[model samples]
Target: MADETPGFELPLLLFAGFRTLIDQLHAELARQGHPDVRPAYGFALQAIGRGGATASELGRLLGVSKQAAGKTVDRLVALGYAVRADDPADARRKVIRLTPHGVDALARSAAIFEELRAQWATALGPGRLRALEADLRAVAPLAGVRLDVPGWFGG
Candidate 1:
């Protein structure tokens, strides 16, 4: 039998799967007291990391303009997920650091992602799920799994 699936369906299906996981993650996050955590915030938080980053540094890491990174930082501060602190190394610069609430949200997000993966393992069978992951890793550039997706998508 000839295969009829279009070439474009592969990327679409992969994106759809990603969307499903993110939607489910956010729903759980809302129930766990982070109702305002958006997907972009997650990426920005990751880029900020434990050591934190200045707006310019974050912009470079996230592949966005400094202005865009500043706007995101503003939102994060407003949402209580992050705070702008005077950089210890340089008095003229400010760094964006995740708050306790942000740390808690990131921890919860990690746990939730594991739970979701387990659910997928149950649905697809453990071996199949592992194989799927392996297959993806084989084809997908490992180095390309980055935190700049929001900017890459022009968000």
Candidate 2:
């Protein structure tokens, strides 16, 4: 059975689609022994960079509380994907940066993304895929959207 109520079906479908893709990649990561590969960690990795970021900036970017961001950061650091450094401008603050191992993992993920894009293009045809992408962009949710992901429709 499906929801027959007004304006409910599309959102459900969207969530299911997102969840499915994430689950597929996550399962693959798990198979490869990549621990702590949750979506939250992914979002945090995307927020950090070569130099890194403060917890408050990550919280603001991800629409989470500072506490939640700190937890995610701590997890990444523990897993060796990130490192915390004292803020040059403010001694009390700290910034997060991707480590060398983190860069390697990120590169692997980028390869996966490229492979997925090729498969999609072959299955859907370039023209139709572009149209589909434009349609999704038009309907995308603005609230709580994370922009740090490697690429959205642009990659």
Candidate 3:
């Protein structure tokens, strides 16, 4: 359904739903003894998990202001989930990467994500969920959208 006035489309609705799912999953993970885990932290963790990305880059990836992004990193750093290293190519900037601890945390978070996906499938039926995902993927390229959140939306 398209928006009557502002012209919202299927992609926007799909994206909103996807974000809600992530948020809910994060909340569940936090409830499961990962009080530090949040949606923003997940973005940070994924960026660092990818290797060789600066704080600014992570910020861009997370769609957060640089200051907000820095705060997220700082929080994660304080929690020992991430670390900053001097960038080899650009001495002026630092690249963020996962510590071993961070990697372990990400692994735990990933397990939670899998569990949630399974739960969703059980509720919605795997066939329906797969079809929905396929429909989203089919229109992604035509709309200049990339739902993939890895490394600049996998660009």
Candidate 4:
């Protein structure tokens, strides 16, 4: 049974929709035999690919404590998607980089996202999709949301 709410809040509705899309993306990834590749991993890969970053810098970018960022790096290392190496200028600090496999996975995931966007356009019509995008772009800066994952949602 569905709850008969008087009115739905726009932000909550948008969040639900976003979650649905993310869930679908994950499902597609699992179907394609990707193992343990969570959305956070994709975000991290994007951050590393843009430029190598230390766990502390990643934490600052992700709006997380350094410890939390370290844990994410540990997971990426375990999954063979990222590696930590000594910084040339500062041997005491380690920098993270995406492996070739990680790059391939990110590319594949991007392809999947494009397919999903096409499906959305088919369902909503190109005009409406474009309008929604415009609305988001106009409103995003007003929300002041922080990125908890490196590159998620254009962070």
Could you say which candidate leads in lDDT?
Answer: 1
Q: Which sections of candidate 3 miss by over 4 Å?
A: 1-16, 89-91, 141-155
lDDT of 2 by residue, 1-155 (tens): 99677798878987797776677666766666565677667767777766688988887766677887788888889999999988889999888888887776666666666666667789899899789778887777455366544223223
Q: Candidate 4 clash total?
A: 0
lDDT of 1: 0.94
TM-scores for all candidates?
Answer: 0.96, 0.77, 0.70, 0.83
Between the candidate structures 3 and 4, which one is better when assessed by TM-score? 4
Clashing pairs in 3: none
Model 4 compared with the native: what TM-score?
0.83
Ranking by lDDT: 1, 4, 2, 3
- Candidate 3 lDDT over 16-110, as tens digits, reads 87787888777876776667776657767876675746767777766666786788888988988888898889799988888877887788778
lDDT of 1 by residue, 16-74 (tens): 99999999999999999999999999999888888999999999888899999999999
Tell me the spans in candidate 1 whose CA falls farther than 4 Å from its real position: none
- Give the alpha-carbon lDDT of every model: 0.94, 0.74, 0.74, 0.80
Q: TM-score of the candidate numbered 2?
A: 0.77
The whole-model C-alpha lDDT of candidate 4 against the native structure comes to: 0.80
